[model samples]
Target: MKNRVSRWLNNEQHLAYSILIPGCALVLVFAYLPAIQSLRFSFLRYNIKMPGAVKFIGLENYQKILADAVFWQTVGRVIYFMTVGGLLVMLLALGMALVLNQEFPGRALLRTLVILPWAIPPVVNGFLWKWILNGDYGALNGLLYQLGLIQEYQFWMANALAALSFAVMTFVWRYTPFITILFLGVLQSIPGELYEQATVDGAGALRRFWYITLPMLSNVGAIAIILTLIAAFTVFDDIVTLTGSYPTFYDATKTPMIYNYEMTFGMGRFGRGSAMAYLIGLLLFALTFFYIRMSLKKED
Candidate 1:
């Protein structure tokens, strides 16, 4: 039996090598390599100034992080960002999907235009919105003033609420296209006869959407939501560009991941920074696990 198995694998050597090579390389470079380095570095006191003073302090980094309140505050900010951004982005995407799914003039053009924000890089998107929300020459303030809506331009990023709202808006703009594209694909997949039958039975547009369209799209919507949630929680570049601890220097808008980068690179605490990165990774993995478990239980 052992010889037979070896013979089979040996006979399919080229095919097995092709499948294993790329996947194994990725695991080695991305998953296992950095992880091993992080584990070793987390236990030691590493800094650029004292490269020779590296010594194992065994959990000191974790203990110090635990004593820091700013870390927890940043965690709170991440939760708020994920929850609020997820809801608004999904809603906006669903609305766009529904509108574009209809037979209307310029629908195709509108669909293409709506997805532009998502196609842009996060850093660019954030700065673009920052410009649009600028106190002096922002398009928003200019338009409002022209409409006689406000007497003066508001300093949007100066106020905490406005800054946070603008950051959330950037998130929505970048992610909504992802939602819209997914929902549109699912909408296109749905059979047209369902809509025709509903209309024949005296169903109006609203009724058809609620009964036929919505029900058909629910599974796709659920999957889109999960994908968006993951993306929302993992967001970094946009927040860093738009806010970057904005409206304040310390913990004003620090996501955990950004905090980790600052700790490692900016503050020169390599060991602690690596630990913080690991903590963020663990939190993300836990959140993903819990969500998947709950979803499975609900289906059961």
Candidate 2:
């Protein structure tokens, strides 16, 4: 026993295991532990009001969720936001980044201005836009009416499409700068020689940009897309404020985050809420996994 213990103690494998202990413990306590609890709660008919009265409901919660028409609608809304809105933000960010990388007057100041929206808090941004986009007395309607562009003020958020558009606007306004900065950092690292070669070969500005600048920026764009996907999928604050959590049926623009919030906290359906939360978590986990895999492939 002593010989075996001594051999194990002297092995480098033991040192490696010791080093991983803290990391493993951290993941267990923070991530896996909470996940397990949530999963268990999802199987029960639980509510926060009646703490000790949880009853096992098997897959009833999942069944009910699948059958609910509203559940599918929210699912569609989330996909639209994550795919279409997220792509718009990323494309705008890339354009801004490329423009800023070129020499121009007050370039530094312009870049600083572009980053202000991203620096502000999400809730604050939501409220600010609310004031600006209000139907009765908003800056947008006020300006347009004064300019004689319309017969009267338009109600921007009274409809689902308008509200969703503004939500996407707010997202792009706040997050495009992040992509801009990332692209800027990557653009700076690219040697000027590539551009010089293109110029020497008589490539025009458009050709150089299309071939050289864009190809060099692909990795940066990929990183930006991953970040945008995560944010778009998990978004809560901005959308909540822009459109109240429980709007009229025709005005329902709820995302997965909103659904989770309403079920868990608002309606007090803890078990069902827990299931929705886990569903969102699963989507995030899969997105991150694929993102990392694609990034590794690019590296290779």
RMSD values, in order shown: 4.5, 4.7
Residue 115: error of model 2 in Å? 1.1
Model 1 over residues 1-300: C-alpha lDDT tens digits?
998767766777766886899999999999899889988888889985679989899999888887879888878877887889999988888888888888999988998898899899999998887778778899999999999999999877776556666777789989999889988998988899988998899999999989988887777677677777778777888878876635472256677777888888888888998878778878778767866865675476
Winner by lDDT = 2
Candidate-wise lDDT, in order: 0.82, 0.82
Error of 2 at 262 (Å): 0.7
How much is 78 displaced in model 2, in angstroms? 1.2
Per-candidate clash tally = 0, 0
What is candidate 2's lDDT per residue for 1-300, written digit by digit as tens?
999877886899996787799899999999999889989989999999888888999888877777878778888887888887788887787788878988999998998899899899999888888778887798998998889987787778766767777887888788888888988888888899988998999999999989988888887677678878898888778877766643662246688788788889988988998888877778899889878976887798
| lDDT of candidate 2 at residue 87, scale 0 to 100 | 83
Over 4 Å off in model 2, which ranges?
1-31, 249-251
